[model samples]
Target: MSTIGSEGWTLVHQARQKHYDDRYYGHWLGTRDDGQWIIGRLYPGKSMDDGFRDGEWAYSKRFAGDPSTDNADAALTAYVEMAHNTFVWDRVFDQTVGEAIDLYWAGPEVPDAPKLAAGWAGAESPNPDRVVSSAGCSIAMPLHEAKFLLLHYLRRTELAAKAHLTKGVTVDRHGAVEKVRCATGPIRFEYGYNTYWLT
Candidate 1:
C-alpha cells in the first residue's frame, strides 16, 4: 500500500532547499487515481511550500489511477539517487584535512616517503599500530608514507560503510577502482601518525 502524506511534503520541502524546482518536482508526486489529488503548478524556482499541496494531490491521483504501479518505489529510488546522494555518509573530517593531504601528496604516482611524512603534522591519526604497520609494509617507511597508507585504509573502511548503508552496494577488495568509485568519486586523502618520536 502506498500513501503520500505529510512525509512526502517534507521531502518536497527538503528538495526545494536543494534548489530542485518544478522540472524536478513531478518525480516526487506519489501516484493518484482520479488525478485530482495532484495539485500545484510547476513553476521555476518556486518555494517547496508552494508546491506541497499540489504534490500531495498528484501523489493521491497517481495512487487512485493505479494502486499497483509502485509509484512510491519509483519516487523513493529517485529520492535516493538525486535528492540524497550524500545521505549514505557523514562529514566526519574537516575539509582542510582533505585539502592539505591532496596539496602535499596527491598525484598520479605515490609520493616519496619523506615528502609524504611532512604532510602529517596536524592530521587525524590512524588507530591500531598493527593496522598501520601492515598498511605501510612494516613501519620503516617515513611517517608520511605510513600516514598516506593509513589514509588509504581508512578511506576503504568509509567506502565500505557507505555502500553497505546505501543501496546495499558492496565492493570487493580485488576491484579497487570500483571501490574508489563507491567512495563518491576520487578526492585527495592523507595519513597521519598518532605521535611523533624525537631522539
Candidate 2:
C-alpha cells in the first residue's frame, strides 16, 4: 500500500492476477487510464480514514474521465484530491486518518449523511478539497472526467444510452435525476450514485 498525496489516504492496489485471502490484502481499488487520464474510483464508499468496514470496501462518492494530463503524478493528485474533498468528513472521521480506522468505525459517532444538491436535485459536496462536482449529486470528476464517463458507458453493450437518452429522462429543474436512459446506462459522477447519462 502506497500513501496518496500529502493526505493520509492510502493507495490500495494489486495486479489483476494478484489476489490474496487476507482481508486487508486489498482489491482492485480504481484506475487512472493513462494518456486520456480517465480517472475513476471503482469503489465509491471506501473511506480513506476508516479503511474497510465489516464487509465494505468504501463509503464515499467520486468520479472518472479521460487523460486530463500526460503526467501520471498530476493525474493521480487530481483523483485523490477529488475523493477526499467530496465526502462527509465528520461521518467517518471524528479526528483524521492519522488516527486509527478500526477505532473510528467502532466509535459512537453519528453517521453524517450526504447533502442533496440545491433544488433537491442531486449530490452537493464532501469537505476535504473538491476538484470538481459533476452530474449534480451523482459524482465528482477531474478535468477529463466528462469524456471519460461518456466513453466508459459507450464502451459497454448492455444499454443503448446512445439511442434512449432524452431530456425527459435527465435531471429535472429540481435536480433529481430519476429514470433516464442510455447505452452505458447512468454515468457515476460518484461511484455508487448515478447522476448523468449520454443524452
lDDT of 1 by residue, 7-126 (tens): 343222122332432333422333233321222223333444454454343322222233322333343334334333322212432232333332222223344424222111222323
Q: How well is each residue in 115-195 modelled by candidate 2, as lDDT tens digits? A: 211111123323345323332222533313333333333223113222223345433311221121111222333222223
Residue 194's lDDT in candidate 2: 27
TM-score of each: 0.21, 0.17
Model 1 stretches with alpha carbons more than 4 Å out: 1-13, 17-46, 54-77, 82-199
Worst 10 residues of 1 by lDDT: 190-199
CA shift of 49, model 1, Å: 1.4
Name the lDDT value of residue 77 in candidate 1.
Answer: 39
